[model samples]
Target: MSEVNAEIARFDLLVDAAWPAPGRAEDGGWVYRHAGGVTKRANSVLPLGERADLPEAVDRAERFYAGIGQPCVFSVGMGASPGLDDELGRRGYRLVDPTLVMTSPISGDEAAVGAAVEDRPSERWLRTWWSVDGGRHRDTGEGPARTWGERILGGVPAGYVLLEEGAVGRGVPQGRWLGIYCMAVEPHARRRGLGAAVLRTLLAWGWQCGADSAYLVVTEANGGARALYEREGFAVAGRYHYRVRS
Candidate 1:
């Protein structure tokens, strides 16, 4: 709830939501799965000490991944123990991107949320988001679009995608709570207050559905986003990183 950084924030969320991969080590730490998304991280604070690879621990991760046949995403951040990077690397896993974590409470009024993404606007908005993402994500399928879309699709936790839309904007809510996972207004759509409207709609959806709190994450470097969220009344809650295996 405090304004912690991304690492701490992610750790807490993972502990609360992610399901650990089986063959958990009794010593501590675990592989987690949430909503069908699989990732590996330390649950409780564990020791990397001087010696990074503890036979039992290394073996557990390898065996678990072998069983699942999926790449276990390792979110490396502040709470991460030493040698984890090296240990996992030696085993052939790589570190991924270290994305920022951000949050804010709902604020502002008069905006509306449109539930069930409208065929025209929703597509437009998502397409813009895709464009903004550029070569970073291959949603366009020309390569960038295809690659990015696949990355996101792959990264999504199972139960979450299987359960909810995770889209928030003015006037949309299926339940008491709505998650604003990807909130992007088209560059052409910017400054028109669509973002604010989206937030309002998301809150409305939540309230209408009976949700108590609304939350989201952003990176510190995202100046425009941070400003918008701040103006809208969302405060920095914490940060977390989704370290891509290198």
Candidate 2:
């Protein structure tokens, strides 16, 4: 693989570790993940590396998700098995959520204001995040979905930040790389600097904990968020999208 592709593969692994699904199984080089269908990233397949029998692997992935009552989905990252995305497309999978992976070096001097960072997400932190982002995916009413979301958040050791009850974010440090996730600011809090504060706080926490670089994933359509991340020194390092069977 080329150097850029290799780096993208590395980031893919870091992202998987950062936001792990509670239920997972492997079929050849493909990983089938499910978390009660809470999020696509958790429920979809990660078709990384190479498969000796690509068609059989795809068939197995479809069956896995079908058994779990989820639409068969594949996260087609830069490191995904060659032609997997095209094969899925030919099989009538609809492409969704073209996303970008951004990265930046951590300076360790990032300042944290009133935001509070915790080892685990608090009830308030979860509620704040759900309030801002949950509605986008599903209903805000809490139950199994919320439970699954929390489980995913706690799958790995990470720093959770809450800023003035209006913003929240999570940072997982994997060696020298920090994976940032769940960045959300309340609708009413958009104009304020709460989002940046939450990000800086997470970066500072990650750097102090030994991470030298940070990365995050954001949907390409989310220009506002992309702008925020860009202003914070994050640049697009890779791209990926999901293919959902129709």
Candidate 3:
């Protein structure tokens, strides 16, 4: 298949696995809660890959979200798929924050890492992680907002690698068939390979948990981290992103 076709195929597979309208949130470009209690988001504010109609799309999406009492979220990565990242931008959707979509291919010969994934995270790690990522959402206590992270956690499918490292951080797992998100390695231990170590450990765990493959989203690119995943045999499968407004 051509690169474009391959990219589209990959997106289709992900959409089917995680964004099935029949299963949950499927309002067609708006937010739809999944039967699994997971929320599915697509860029309804704009055409897939077309930044031109984004303004109108966001307007329509925002109105839809308000009417439905749900928030609009988009899934973006390095893959070639349809998304509303741009329309959301012109409509005042701020392109902010970072979420990773990573994948780990399964194999018989590939070695499964056995490093211990910390079930108990250190207080310092948790504090620092929350400081960097948690923000006001912890204290907001607003409708839907109160359960921000909680919803994501609660919605995790049955076979996902969802190990929580005590108070430190929650492991968001994503591989070929699964995608990990919001990975935090903590500030004090920044230089060390703890973050990558945790990822490898989780990938290993994901394989053991019966996930055939995995994938996650990464922003632009970090030389060191990108190199590491590449060394571990990961490549950019596709890209998806949308504009966000605060």
Listed per model in order, the count of residue pairs whose N, CA or C atoms clash below 3 Å is: 50, 0, 45
**RMSD (CA, Å), each prediction:** 8.3, 1.9, 6.4
Q: What is the lDDT ranking, best to worst?
A: 2, 3, 1
Q: Alpha carbon lDDT of residue 33, candidate 2?
A: 87
Tens digit of per-residue lDDT, candidate 2, span 180-234: 9999989888889888999999998888899999999999999999999999999
Models 1 onward score TM values of: 0.52, 0.95, 0.58
**lDDT per prediction?**
0.44, 0.87, 0.46
Candidate 1: lDDT of 108?
33
Which has the better TM-score: candidate 2, or candidate 3? 2
**Evaluated with TM-score, which candidate comes out highest?**
2
Best by lDDT: 2
Candidate 3, poorest ten consecutive residues by summed lDDT: 159-168
Model 1 is weakest, by summed lDDT over 10 consecutive residues, at: 158-167
lDDT of 3: 0.46
lDDT of 1: 0.44
Off by over 4 Å in 3: 1-25, 28-59, 66-104, 108-132, 136-138, 141-146, 158-176, 221-224
